[model samples]
Target: MGDGRANNPNSHSNNSSSNKPEWLEQYDVIGKIGEGTYGLVFLAKVKSNRSKPIAIKKFKQSKDGDGVSPTAIREIMLLREISHENVVKLANVHINHADMSLYLAFDYAEHDLYEIIRHHRDKVNQAINPYTVKSLLWQLLNGLNYLHSNWIVHRDLKPSNILVMGDGEEQGVVKIADFGLARIYQAPLKPLSENGVVVTIWYRAPELLLGAKHYTSAVDMWAVGCIFAELLTLKPLFQGQEVKGTPNPFQLDQLDKIFKVLGHPTQEKWPMLVNLPHWQSDLQHIQGHKYETAGLHSVVHLSHKNPAYELLSQMLEYDPRKRLTAAQALEHDYFRMEPLPGCNALVPPQPGEKVVNYPTRPVDTSTDIVGTISLQPSQPVSSGNSVSGGNPGRNGWRNKSWQHSDAARCCTASSSTAADKKERIRNGDDWIPSTTEIEALLSFLI
Candidate 1:
């Protein structure tokens, strides 16, 4: 119940406030869940009711340096403002004066899209059923649509960031998480680029790659398109190698990979293409290549004429203006087709055979309930044999035994950066590494 122990005595200095916040005693800290760029996350429960589990995200706070991380502030502000079923809920906030740490309590999500997709592709040794895929995408779109309508752009929309409810009445419901890279795009002090690189390289839109200073929520749509393709193929669509050295705005290599399949974009196709800061340099490289437009079907392996493919194409459209908005994407006939998007992403329609039992999110039992722990790289653990235990509460998955002991890891589950992960995908390696390069890039810019 009461933070297990008092705040670390050494955490407070004579000049600093030693008083612990009132909310600190309210939640029973269970154990550490996972670490991120900002700070560590812990699985916890209300002291009054142990049955109700929640996730508490502790953001890093520096001593004798800056105050709370700006990213953390932005996340708190935006999350508190937006209330939607498809979005992760922020239930409470706690400030530990002893360490100046910011803690956010949110509804705990048992699984994420990355884990689900990886389980099917590598562990389950089968494709995720179309009904499941449709359901997840629909809920994702529903959330993204709400954000866009409210003039918010989820700059970083990737598999790892999309959370899925693994149990409870909200079981299988998809909730979009990680507002660290999200931005209120209605108006801004400067061009979005002034905030440094936004989306991850793999899901990054073409305009961002070409150094488009002023951008729109369409960037998020482009990412959703990439995510849709990944869901179907169980692999990133344009898994191009990230450019090293100084953060180049042109990113010719990434563009080359996209052009190879989607074909080169011309000024005629994208009216603003020629005006981008790095457009001239990018054009120089693109002009040398005679790349033919390879339709989405060739790369994704989906039905060439299916509504899903058509929608994918629209989402991955070269021109941001032409890309399907979340609202327009939801209106696509893909959702209207047979086997309509279901309420749950994991629930099988017309149940018969048993499904794979996914493991619960790994929780590190070693970490104590110390006030505001530092962000340390956790030892990568398989989804199976997590510290908290292995039962992923899914209806069809219960009582099913797995033949293989070592289940495949999610796309970003490992310690690899997005760029390195893309390289692994290119090299045909099964081990995928996941890191938020935005934080790395922002470190350089800041």
Candidate 2:
């Protein structure tokens, strides 16, 4: 809690600043749970009923010191219209008339996929029980099915964004939080204009990496595939580095890593692949080397005969058109196999399976609720595992807060440019052999 981190979340104190808004007076501002570029999330309990906990997200004002943040407005507008058990519910929305700062409150989720996975991998040092895995994935897809059915695409689906309830009636229920990047696909996509980057690099779909000007809901399904792989193997399936820059930077390393496992995309498999902007313009760098899709089973340590593998293969299909929708995924044989998925993800579905007691999310009880938090980011971590003492994964998940991860950073830094490090890798605008490329190629082959 000393450095705005949640090392000890159980420590509690009612540390609200005197400047706290009048509306916030109804709830006891317990502490800060998370801080991201958009705002700070505080943990609070209703004064009338302390049993009911709430997550209060206070949006930061724009650099121009203007009115409410547009992202906040978008989240409010979309969430207010949709209602689902799997989706995070927006309980209240309040605005400060003086500063015009905005606040959105929702139910506090105790754990997220990122934290749960890390606990199993690091603390418990065991694979998550297959029954628990099935249950978690089932609920995730069930929730996603509801969203897709309603025509919404969660562009930024990842482990961290999928939150799980801690206790009380909704315990173990999965709630897909953070709707900032969510979009109703009933409207046509506006390409990079909407967000410099859509999905986070690691979980991003092939069509997106290939720079498809127009994409579909299939993108979210692709991320679901990535999350499923992580759940199965306890590590990311594709690890790619994002070149930090303004405008756009071709993600050569990520594609190479994906290709190494899934193989190169051929015209026969994905007929429309050739028409994508990056696939056309960056073909020379991409197609020059061919890859074979033979390592998935071995890497995941699952037999080709396994039902889980069959479902995973479908989800990770190279062609977005061929990928399984969340609805279709829910009907997969994997979920119907022995030890069928259960409603509660945290508990073992069957009697013999191990029950994992996950650590609860921490709250910073010392931070003043209305006090200023540092907006300047420290040097970014290469991946989310740095604090947890794990490897820097492929895709480089830099930030650790609720919405401060790599995908969301693209929104705030849309106008900012990376250092001129590209000069070192370019030979008069031509990409040539370098240590970075060699390492990326080595990673690809592995």
Candidate 3:
């Protein structure tokens, strides 16, 4: 079923039906854009409206032969509850009951920070514009603030996960994608250490490395801080080698890398430092080494006087409590300065600087999604499992998009009764829980 014109952008809409997966009839899948631990992602245009481009993410059924993976259900439920301008918008859902495969549709973003940073580093051999950096960070923090306010914690935040919209009315808009590791965190609950892995190694928070049983939104802040520094320097702030194993081994190397630049964590500086799960067991060897020679300002080339430096320091703080929250970071002096952050991250405020035309995300159309993953039989999808992924604007989510997106979007998720919801899913005859349906994911949390 692979297309001969795999690289031809014009051939994306051709739905030569022979051998095409019956489930994929609704979309003219252009090509596979990306794949990761979760599933494969395809670039497709709506068959009914070829002009509307969207990304279709396909996930294999759980190993237990259940309909949707628990993680995926959690992701979808969280997404349905999420409605923000800086958050990726879910468009539709496709469920292949034959193989228990689930497909989610989202607005196609042309650029992500990972590609943008790589382009600046490898292709252009230059630093990202300061105005552009500030704008991106501001939008990122703003979106994060909305998530935190809604009790959602995006544990896996990195350059690749932060997507920037392509040319459109929302061009230059920052959209935070990938909620695979996110969960609703209400205080006084069980420890979050159950899941083991969280943020990426390079962007991981210090407390997580030290083994904090109960972390908070501060973890996300640390990742944003790392991303902020990367934008300035075009390199990872702490490029640590992750140790792969079960039960999530203590990342000694990662902590050592962080300690080298930020110095050792003293009891007085971080009072709760001693109470961490791995404080005594993992940090004994590196306890006495005082790493003062390579401070953050010098590492990232930021002066101590600059507000950006201050913000970065707070984000990398060893103590989670000391770390800045998304709301507080957004109000910092860095964003209040001249050439302030604008609505469009691509359009800079500088008079002389020209707009940066970011490279489009690559697509490989040679492979087809029909036989991508081995098929398995599973039980029928449960009610409230299917998602149609409604438009955020139509749900009246735009006005308060910046506030609690999860809470607002979840309200609609709960507006329908169980019987009605079940009836709707039955009528659709597909298990598609599309959009940021945050509530569907709540059962997996806590």
Q: Top lDDT: which candidate number?
A: 3
The ten-residue window of minimal lDDT in model 3 covers 1-10
Error at 185, model 1, angstroms: 1.1
lDDT of all predictions, in order shown? 0.79, 0.78, 0.81
Q: What is the C-alpha RMSD, rounded to one decimal, of candidate 2?
A: 19.6
Q: Which candidate do you rate higher for TM-score, 2 or 3?
A: 3
What does candidate 1's lDDT look like per residue over 245-275, in tens digits?
A: 5554456778888888798788787888888
Flag regions of model 2 displaced more than 4 Å: 1-19, 189-194, 373-446
lDDT of 3 by residue, 1-446 (tens): 11122222222223344444444666787889999888899998877775688898988556874657878887888898999999988876666544556788899989999999999999988999888899999999999999999999999999999999889888889999998889899853557768758888899888888878788999999999999999999999899899999777888889889888888888999999888877877545667555775489998998999999998888887788989999999989999998799878987756778777888878898977765743332343443323444545655656656457587667766676666878878898766776575766776573
TM-score of each: 0.77, 0.78, 0.79
Badly placed stretches (over 4 Å) of model 1 are 1-22, 245-249, 371-446
Q: What shift in Å separates residue 65 of candidate 1 from its native position after superposition?
A: 3.3
Question: Which tens-of-lDDT digit does each residue in 1-446 have in candidate 2?
Answer: 01112211211112334344456667888899899878899998878785589998988866774656667777987898888888898888865444445678898899999998999898988888887788888888988899888888888999999998987888888899899888777864354335656777999888888877777788888898899889988898898998788665778888888999988889999999989888888757898887875688888888999999999989989899999999899988888778888778787645765667889778899986757533222333332223544345545555444464565677546534433435544535655546767877887666
Q: Model 3 scores what on Cα lDDT?
A: 0.81
Error of 3 at 271 (Å): 0.3
